[model samples]
Target: MATYLDTPGRVCRSLSEEDMELVHALQINGRASFREIADVLGISDQTAARRWARLRSAGKLRVLGLTDPIRLGNSVWLVRVRCTPDAASSLGKAMARRPDTTWVNLDSGGTEISCSVRTRSPGPEESPLLQKLPRTPQVVDLSAHCSLHVFFGHDLGPINKRGPLTAAQVAALTPPDTPDRATDATPPVPLDDSDRQLLDLLARDGRAATGDLAAATGLSPSTVRRRITELRSAGALYFDVEYHPDILQQSFRAALWLEIDPSRLAEAGSALAAHPEVAYATATTGTANLYASIDVATAQLFYRYLTESVATLPGLRHTATAPIQRTLKGPGPYLPTTA
Candidate 1:
């Protein structure tokens, strides 16, 4: 167990305000080229490329395809908890190491620690996903909320004409990367507006059958299937489930945030990312900035793990937690529109 006194044994820093603005632009549309970001941020494409590279080397960002779990036949849950004022945060931080958890936020606004979790149920007849919650401790309060809507992924606050995603939501969905993109170009194909309409249908319902897709897309079933296949092959479409733990019976989740010494960031980040209970970790720019999402069975189980497992982690000190209400979105590339 690492003592609180040794907190921030290493430090991880986020981008500057200028960098953050660029990030917001890129995050709003990962497909945006350095040229696009530079155009928006009023900088040269070379400068944008350098800044993005720096952001990645700092372990501060990622860009992947985000998916919806409901269409994939999964469940979602929100777990909120409270622990000893001193113990509350540390407990949350430990459980975040678990793979079962997905989103973690510690000491969010003021009162509670929260985590939003998504789980894949074992079987339609078997509810191993929900029944599995009580097996762990370190949770005090657990509640459930539906992910009614997903307004935006990168930034959730209000939007206006000046906001990046406001007037151009759909147009902002797909992006074109800068010159040094991560991969080589994909071979081209022939899919016209009708084919695009088919894609739009699948976007709303990934599980839609070929016949249904064809009907909605105004194409032959075979053509629809071929195009869909091509899209999936081209890395454009994916299918997966989103689990609702509360409905399935496992509503326990929480977000854990840790503050570590700047000197120990690499070691600490690597160690915590590989922790047993932690699900997600983000190195942010604030006092207690290391954020992770965790999941556990019960408050008692949560307690045992914290006191026994995470309490002793090296290079860790101060901690905080909050109960998650819902997964704003499943663990896919949380992206804005292409517009």
Candidate 2:
């Protein structure tokens, strides 16, 4: 099947110090010129450009804008799912393909899968993802919990952070007067095991060579090259970036867990998912109907989002904020590496 790689957020398995620095530079300011990044790292512009191409081509980096969903008028939900052991992967993939889904992950301890998605209701609403979900046939029973805030969106995008960026990288990455374009949809493609392995390599070390991927996947260098060509053509891969939330002055990021009527799930969830501010939204089964995270500049901004933005959403039962303390990992945690 064809897979699209343009999900709202991104993540990597691991990164080196220099790679982290590069990710930081882009996160702080994505529009930085090769020359500017070079200056900060004390490298040449040509070198910066070359390394960037490698990372970007491999889907180890991204340059996209993030907005606060509440500001865009949306409610949130967190879903904990209990599925048949054999049904988890199929169910998760189905959810991931939805336009409203922002993040999807499975935990090993149980038959539970967790997902977060956003929705906007006209007068406090339920998420639509639930309706579509039961119809898909992979899920058994679902349980949902509303979120007050995101403890951290670890594994969402590139970069590991305890707090804000340091002085130098931040200075280099500060958002430009004009930022990079943020598009949710992109092309699609078929991915093979070799492509997966190559993507894994770049996720950890962007500067890794084709020969390295060739060796890792047990394919000839030429075969690895062919698969990468297909992955890029199909849009199943993108680069990893070290985004600096502080540079954008986004000191606050939170999730609001909400409950809504199942009948109104589709209507409410669709509206919320369309907003630019919503990182991602989804419908799930259980106690709380929906969950999502938002990014904003300050406490006042958060209020505005709540009062004006979220107030207007449909099917909203309960809405409260739980702010993230720290992100232990990005949205997509690293896959285990072999060889």
Candidate 3:
């Protein structure tokens, strides 16, 4: 069954200020209610709710709740699969359906499929594709980079319009950063069935109504709300808002592979995340210990960032760059109108 987000022939339009404001608000706090968002933006709750419904119906926006696999004591790895031309489409789609893979895409050439996969540990069936690919006739080559430290990914991307939300407005929308909440450095926790169900619903729409969730899960609205709060406090889930990069004039996109000293790895990753050009970055276990995604205005600007900015970082041993020809799947489902 096809969904509106993946349906064909959808119209792609640019977002207005109202739309942009709502998008930014969600980026700040994905679970904020229409009333809370309205309070911050000085609009009616109905208006905020209607606008969001329109955006989702038009396939212009996506809100996702994703678990940090690495923090969960799972192995996160970036994989590049080289397959025959005929097998590319089928192989990529097959990998995307797996619960383990995220950000799956067919790179510049259709023959190569690039994606990141997470696993609790190494086993024959830990990553079905990784193990099976080596023996499969169509898969010619495979490269896997184990993510050691993640500076940024998913929800950590920079917001398009930062100036629209005043400091007070942002503070109003944001949840209090309690001591129990997990940070990048914090360890992981175990999740129960209810937690998984909440995550599954939020993965489809982070702003889903508590009443709707209650209906689906056979739980009271209050129980659903309390569960969400508990999960958030445990740092078991975080929300990601997906939007078109071209809207912000970042047309050129590139993938970076870097090698750094093990001792300074976390420090280096943190520094890379501070740069606006870096949409994603991580420290992996491979020849190239670090990997990053860059979105810039022009090719020249990317070159300058690589030479001038990236060069200044300490313990940087080697670097490699690859351009992302196309994105088959991003944070959430690949939306044709939005992408």
Q: Write the per-residue lDDT of candidate 2 for residues 26-103, one digit (tens) a residue.
A: 654444677888888878999888877876666455453233333334444566566788877666666665545544
Angstrom error at residue 319, model 3: 1.3
Off by over 4 Å in 2: 1-14, 122-126, 134-138, 150-165, 176-339
lDDT of 3 by residue, 283-308 (tens): 77787888888877688999999999
lDDT of each: 0.47, 0.53, 0.73
- Candidate order by decreasing lDDT: 3, 2, 1
RMSD list, candidates in order: 18.0, 12.3, 3.9
**Model 3 alpha-carbon drift over 4 Å, by segment:** 1-14, 122-125, 160-163, 177-187, 244-248, 333-339
Which candidate number maximizes lDDT?
3
Q: Output the TM-score of candidate 3.
A: 0.86
Residue 193, model 2, lDDT = 63
Residue by residue across 206-271, what tens digits does model 1's lDDT show? 445668778777789898867755554444444322222222122344666667777765556666
Shift in Å, residue 179, candidate 3: 6.5
Candidate 1 segments whose C-alpha is farther than 4 A from its true place: 1-21, 39-43, 83-90, 107-112, 121-130, 135-141, 151-339
